[model samples]
Target chain A: MPKIVAFACEHSAYEAATAALERKTGTAVSGENPRFPIVEVEILKVPCTGRVEVIDILKALEGGAGIVVLLGCFEEACHYLTGNVRAKKRVGYVRRIIQDIGLEENRVQFFSLAPDMDARFSGIIEELSKQVVNMGPGPVTRIRDQTTKEQAQAAQAR
Target chain B: MIVAEQKPVAEILRMIEGYRKILVVGCGTCVTVCMAGGEKEAGILASLIRMAWAREGRLGPLIDVSETTVERQCEWEFLQEISEKVAASDAVLSMGCGAGVQAMARMFEGKVILPALNTKFIGMPERQGLWTELCAGCGDCVLDRTGGICPIARCSKSLLNGPCGGSQNGKCEVSKDIDCAWQLIFDRMKSLGRLEALGAMLPPKDWSKNRDGGPRKVVREDMLL
Candidate 1:
């Protein structure tokens, strides 16, 4: 299963992902949140979605994440007033960049949901993991245990 | 301020191919205000190029990328900060305007400095997320007669006399969104009780003072001392 990294805003998506995990595991883990037990989802908590930038998303791809998901508050209900909106624009920009690079533009995804929407959160993770697995291996450099350059060199050697 | 736009990502990637060490330099003045070539922009472009090539499965020990932004690229004093980096890199993907690119060229002879921005025009922010051209740098000054508006910059015809026959409802023939510069001039002059000035037949503009004069220079002997 391909691991998908979601930049979950603390105000919303993180809470919802926590809720989903709590419902599944019956307890919350301290510190770093591990990958979803059922699906390969790495939930990286952020202060707000608006803080997510074009470079962040692109770097995630370069760092070996199969697909990057940006989860923020609803467009009009952004905790920072326009953080979610800014995240949306960055997501759009990354999509265009990916499209221009002749890759699957959908690798970068954006979603708006509240903290209580655990069911939706679980569904998105499962769906994304399944989607990436079906898409098979992408041209993205899988950093693995080696440096990104070394990984790319291995890929080149292939 | 001078407004500029970044060239396409693909085109930029194409420009830096085969170069071992690439330096992405951004200008902190006008291009920064316009969100084109600035420190933040330079970092973003560097990361972008790194990822794009990595995705292509061709990134190895061959190509390395670095980025820096100066306070102003057109000034030699500010450019001295990045002199060593410029000398070491195979190519510089400059995020500055055309002048900045040329300045780099003149300052560091034989170094390859590639332009990453298409220097658009002298413009000001129309609103929060919009910009509009405001000047053309014409050697002649006529704003005193045209009620503080430049017909050459705003009008499609660059007419000095008045609005062309195509102007209607204070809008230019080129587009409805564009206000006719002559209409604006007339209205401004009329409000200032200077409408009589427009009736006077002005002679033809001196074309030699413009770009037709070839590469021009402003030698201020007083300032040289």
Candidate 2:
């Protein structure tokens, strides 16, 4: 299955995502279908979404993640004052870089929500899953694997 | 400090499309302070370049990117440390100002040094994330007479004598956002009790001291000797 890397803020999205995960796990423990098993997401907790750098987003895609998401607090409600604001600007900047690189601008995404919005978190995951299903396998992984194979082949020939 | 902004990624990508290996060299001085070309920015640019090419898959050979920074690219000693990196790559993507890029180009002599920044101006930060120009570097001093306000840089017309008729509501004729330099000069001088100094009409500015001459240089005989 394709992978999705979501950088979630501990202050907001992380807690909400945790709640959603716990709810899903409980339903599965009761012998019912685990709905979230379909969407493969690796949630990395960050102190603040503002701490997310532009290079990190590119690195995630380079590391085989199908898509990258930045989840943070709402506008004017960031615990560190302007962390969310800065995160938004960084998202826009990264989007421009990837767009210029000929990739879909939607490859990178940003969202804002409170800590208690578990349902919203679930919706975001479902949306990403649908996106990847339509997009198919990411070209980044194929290109990277091909580059590695070519380098190895050149070494053997040498 | 000198201010600059990064060029669009598309333009930068176009310039390096032919090169198999590229080195992004950043300056640690003015460009870093202005948030245009710094160590972090260099990393961002390198990553973008790498990924862009990797996604291309068949644009040509895979382009590899490396990043490094110098204390000051304008000086020779600082640039010496990156000699090995410079030799390893076909093109050097300089994230420094005009002088830094030219210095690298001269030092390497054979390699291509591409500029990644558009040098903006000599200015100071007016507020958080905001920088405003304060000097024109006209090779002449006029601040002592205008109560320290620079009419050459602040005024749209670079007026030497009095406020022009275009000044309205304490703003310049260029735009409402720009404050009138004469208004600021008058207010500052009035508060300093130096308004009487304006009674004398000043002579016309000497254009020879400005950029009228081709490429001016300074020499220090005592230090050189």
Candidate 3:
């Protein structure tokens, strides 16, 4: 099973995640709150999905999350009119960064939700979790170990 | 402005093949404003090339891909600033406009100067989010009659007489959505009471002054080197 770290903002996505857990829904939806599977996933609640930075997402990848998902409010529904759009742009920047660093772009994903869509949130999480399971461990974690070794050799050479 | 667009990544990669030591030079002027051959884009391209090289299990030559310490106007002193970095590398990839690339080629005679972007056209910002090429450098500008609109500049056919028979209701035949530049000029001139000026027969444009021969040269005694 892939270790999934999901960032749910303080707004609708968190509420939906909680609702999904209460409803025992195996899927991730947008607005409705549903139940979540307890064993394979860890959820981190943030102030706002827009608050999450590219560096933070990269740190999560380095920390062994096979897949990291950013859950935020819908595009035009953010409390801040363009916050979601900004978040999308940052996500795209980080995606390019990861790809440049030789990691698959699919390791990072973004989803939007409203306060009431628990079932949809749960469904999305379930589907993404399964996808992550099939994709296996992320490339960054594997590459870091080798990079560290190379750095050690370079240090010794000096 | 020196406008340019990024070359395809695959094409850039292929051009740098077999070169171990590579120097990526970025321009900080027009290419930067256009988001093509600027510092950030140069860094991205360098990183991507490094990653691609790593995939082949061959650590590249002492590749030092860095930006040129210059603006995008092709001045010689600015090109001189990157002389040390350029000398250290085996090949150079310039992320600049065509003028900048040509300047680098001229300054560093015999050195391989590869262009990382395709030079486009001179254009101005349409509004905040768009840019439209309005000038064609026809060697003659007639902004007097059309209220600053150059029919030669914006018209698809460069029609100086009247809108071709293809014009419909004031839009160009080439594109229905675009207002005919000639029509816009005529309307503006007519409103300005300059319509009678348009009735005067203008002679045929001198094509020899444009590009009939080889490259054109302009000499200014006041700015002589």
Q: lDDT winner among the candidates? A: 2
Give one digit per residue, the lDDT tens place, for model 1 in B108-189.
8999989999999899988866889878878887888888999889989888878899999999999999999999999999
Off by over 4 Å in 3: A1-72, A86-108, A113-158, B58-69
**lDDT tens per residue, model 1, A25-90:** 321323222334443556789999989877788777766677899988997788889999889988
Per-residue CA lDDT of candidate 2, range B103-211, in tens? 9999999999999999988888888778888888788879999999999988888988889999998998889999999999999999999999977687877878889
DockQ of each: 0.46, 0.58, 0.16
Q: List the residue pairs that clash in candidate 2.
A: none
Please identify model 1 stretches exceeding 4 Å from their true place: A25-40, A135-140, A143-158
Better of 1 and 2 by lDDT: 2
- For every candidate, how close is chain A to the native chain A in TM-score? 0.80, 0.82, 0.78
Q: How does chain A of candidate 1 score by TM-score against the true chain A?
A: 0.80
Instruction: Arrange candidates by DockQ, descending.
Output: 2, 1, 3
Docking class of 3: incorrect
Reference-based TM-score of each model: 0.88, 0.89, 0.72
Model 1 interface RMSD, in angstroms? 2.5
Worst 10 residues of 1 chain B by lDDT: B53-62
